[model samples]
Target: MPEPIIEIKDLTKDYEGKRAVDHLNLNINKGEIFGLLGPNGAGKTTVILMLLGLSEPTGGSIKISGYDSTTEPLKVKKITGYLPDQVGFYENRTGLENLLYTARLNGISGKRAYESAEKLLDIVGLREAKYKKTGIYSKGMKQRLGLADVLIKEPEIIILDEPTIGIDPKGINEFLDLIRKLSKDKGITVLLSSHLLHQVQKICDRVGLFVDGRLLAEGNIDEMAEKLFNNKEIAIKAQVSNITQDLIDDLKKIEGIRKVSYSGDWLIIKSIENVTPAIAKSIIAKGGSLYQLSYEKYGLDEIYQYYFEGGVRHD
Candidate 1:
């Protein structure tokens, strides 16, 4: 495996008498979108603050690109770009002016800065709006500009905290697609922190479940389901033209099938693996018509429901 671009070991944080983060350990691979998934006040923001060297950890360590966040904070910040929940810009300045100002702050002024700023504006789909004052831009437009601001520094890693909080559904989709495109094209590692499960699941290559400042699990959706459910049986739903006791019994007898039953016009089969192919063949051989077949996808929705709402202990 490749070395992780971000590494945290035994990280902990405290505010007053309460512990905000508890012995958190995580590693993020280079160029992959890693989501910090959790509910509000779950210490996700604390972790990001510590990673960016904006806040000190109460204990343990954080390393980004071989630089210690606590000791070499300047070095860490030099290559890391952060976009907080709210993005602020010079409201009176045009979008292009705002980007140019950022470029100048980073010491890339003159024709090069102007050219880069214009290109970034086009890449972010704001070329036409480039000359418009940010005060008149909508929330989605501001977010797009915020992303352009972050990229102006040309950082290797970008940390976004609740980046899509108030945007409409369509805008959210477009923003996510842009993030994915940047990660793939520029090979920039992205660390996204969000409480929206479905949105995170849509674009994240992997995710870490954080609750109450503790990371319960981290992996892809399927891998996390297996870890949390202990390889729990899957349910397959099928709709056929005919249903009979004989057919149900035959389905139960199929290898890997644990149980079979019917409801209305649908058949519900609980199995250890996908047996849809076998099920369709049996339906046709039994002089029945197979109308529909669907296997339950083990996704973030189910995982979140099972762990948080189902009262299943992570331990």
Candidate 2:
């Protein structure tokens, strides 16, 4: 385990009479990509904004690298870069110009800003079009440019909100690759908030599941699965040729095996523990040819669905 660079405790935000964030607590480790997940109206953006000190918390505290987000916001801003759901850039300004402007705002100037901006433009794959006005850039290009703009501050932490929301599949893939590369190469911590479960599953090291402003669970894929499926049965699917009723009965008789049934060429096995290898051996011994055998594991989407619908208790 790594040291936690961001520690949040009892963080809360109230919107008029409604509670947007209800006592959320989380620890984000240094150099790790942590995904903040939930449906719309779940306060995911509120948490992110509070983390960056862009919005004040109604209650509780947030410490980033020991700098209090509420009190020493300037210090927090120096090390944190935030990209909103919709990135804004001067449409008339060239991509290079936008980055340079950000650099100047951060107190970097002259050769340093220019050189740094060039490298970042190249890093984000916008070098050739660096001088072209951003108005001519596509949505993906603007997103990439926004990334370069954020990097102008040399932030230790990068926070992105729904970065791939409207991106085409190909563009989303490219952007995600760049995000992973940046984190790995720069040793920068990243906190991502998105409703896209598959995309988050592809990259997040761990995730905090949020619902109605409260964290329902915080864990990696396997850990959350264990918590949610503590007593659930495992399903195994096997495709075999020339199956027999006798073989099904034999499989059902195996201790710990809950159920056995076959449909067409697919044999479904329900068991408490993994006994696929034994099942395969038995099928082979029964003079059956095995073509495919696989056990089913819950994907993030499935696990998320189970968590919310199962009425998970927030801890």
Total clashes for model 1: 0
Cα lDDT for residue 28, candidate 2: 96
* CA shift of 196, model 2, Å: 0.7
Superposed on all Cα atoms, the candidates' RMSDs to the truth, in angstroms, are 4.8, 4.4
Clash pairs detected, candidate 2: none
- The residue-by-residue lDDT of candidate 1 on 170-287, one tens digit each, is 9999999999999899999999999899889999999999988899999998899888766676878899988998898788778999878799889988788888899888888888
Question: Residue 269 of model 1: what lDDT?
Answer: 87
Candidate lDDT scores, in order, read: 0.90, 0.89
Candidate 1 similarity to native, TM-score: 0.81
| Candidate 1 residue spans exceeding 4 A from truth | 231-297, 310-312
- How high a TM-score does candidate 2 get? 0.82
User: On residues 1-315, what C-alpha lDDT tens digit does candidate 2 reach at each position?
Assistant: 679999999999999999999998999999999999888778999998888888999999999999999898999999999899999789999998889999998999999999999999989899899999999999999889888888889999999999998789999999998999999999999999998888898899999889889998889988987776777667799999988998998788777799897899999887888899899989998999999999887657667775566656645
